[model samples]
Target: MDKNQLGVQYMQEGNWEEAAKAFNDAIEENPKDPVAYINFGNVLSAVDDDEKAVKFYQKAIEIDEHAGAAYYSIGNVFFTQDRFTEAKKMFETAMKKGLESSDNFFMLGLTLVQLNQGKLALPYLQRSVELNEHDAEARFQYGLCLAQLELIDEAILQLEKCIELDPDHSDAFYNLGVSFAFKETSVKAIEMFNKALEIQPDHLLAGHAKKLIENNL
Candidate 1:
C-alpha cells in the first residue's frame, strides 16, 4: 500500500508514532506531497508538538496554496494558543478556500463567542445548528449566542431543542434553566435545574441554578 494510505491507517488506529513515521517516509519519497505534510502535521499536533506541526502545515500550504486542511490545522493550533483572532482568520480563509464543513462553522462561531463577538458569531453558530440540528453542543452554543443577543425566546427554543436531542445533556438543561431565570420564571428554572441534576447528580451549574431558584422563591 502507498505510504499515505499506511499513514492514514496508522492515524486511525491511534498509532501516532507510526503515523508520523509513515507520513515522514511519504514526504521523503515525494517532498511535494501536500497530503503527507498535512498528515504529518496532524500526527505532530496529536503528540502536542504544535511548533513542528505548524511548520509541516506551512509546508503543506506552500505546496498547495489552497490546502484547506492545512489552514484548519493551523487555525486549531492558534486556537489552542488562545489567539482567537488569528484562529478565526485562518478558519475564515479555509472556508473561503472551500473548506466548508460543520466543524469549520462551529470552530469559527466558538472563536467569535470567545472574543465576545457573539453578534458576529450568531450566523455561523446558526449555520452549525442548521448543518447538524441533532448536534447537542451546536444547539447549546446557538442558544448561548441568541441569549447574548437578548433573543430570549429564540435562545429557549434552541436550548429546548438541544435537550430534546440529548436528554442527558446536563449543560443544555442548566442553560435552559438560566434562560428561564432570565425571564423571571423561577419555577420553570427550578424544574429544568432539577432535570439537570437528575441526569448529572454532581452538576455544578445545576446546583447553582437550584440555589438561585430558592433565592427567587
Candidate 2:
C-alpha cells in the first residue's frame, strides 16, 4: 500500500504516534503534499502538542493560502493558549477565506465575549443561533451579550430559550435568575435559583441566589 494509505490506516486504528511517523514519511517522500502536513498536524493536536501542530498547520496554509482548515486549526491553537487577540485575528482570516462552519462562528463569538467585546460578538453568535437554535450554550451566551447591551427583555427571552432547550443546564437557570434579579423580580429569581439547585446541587451561584432571595424576602 502507499504511504498515505498506510498512514490513514494507522490513524483510523488510533495509533497516533505511528500515524504521525507514517505521515511524516509521506511528507518526506512528497514535499509538496499539503494533506500530509494537515494530517500530521491533526495527529499532533490529538496528542496535545498544539505548538507543533500549529507549525504543521501553518505549513499547510503556506502550501495553500486558501486552506480554511489550516487557518481554523491555528486559530484553535491560539485559543487554547488563551491568546485571544491572535485567535480572533486567525478566525477572521479563516472566515475571510470562506470558512463557513457554525462552530467556527461560535468560537469567534465566544472569543469576542471573553474579550468583553460582546457587541462585536453579536453577529457571529446570532448566526450560530440561527444555524442551530437548540444550542444551549450559544443561546445562553447570546442572552449574555444582549444583557451586556442593556437589552434586558430580549436577554431574558434568550435565556429562557436556553433553559427550554436543555432543562438540566444549571448555568442557564442561574443566569436567568440574575436577569430576574436585575428587574427586581425577587420571586421569579428565587424560582430560577431553585431550578438551578435542582439541576446542580453544589452550584455556588444557586446557593448565593438563594441567600439573596431570602435577604430580599
Per-model lDDT:
0.91, 0.88
Cα distance off (Å), candidate 1, residue 61: 0.6
- Candidate 1, backbone clash total: 0
RMSD to truth, every model: 1.8, 3.2
Q: Write the per-residue lDDT of candidate 1 for residues 117-179, one digit (tens) a residue.
A: 999999999998888877888998999899889999999999999888889888888888888
Candidate 2: list runs displaced more than 4 Å.
Answer: 1-36
**Residue pairs that clash (backbone atoms under 3 angstroms), model 1:** none
What's the CA error at residue 75 for candidate 2, in Å? 1.1
- What TM-score, computed on C-alpha atoms, does each candidate reach? 0.91, 0.84
Q: lDDT for model 2, on a 0 to 1 scale?
A: 0.88
Candidate 2 lDDT by residue in tens digits, 18-59: 898899999999988877888899899888999899899989
Name the lDDT of candidate 1. Answer: 0.91
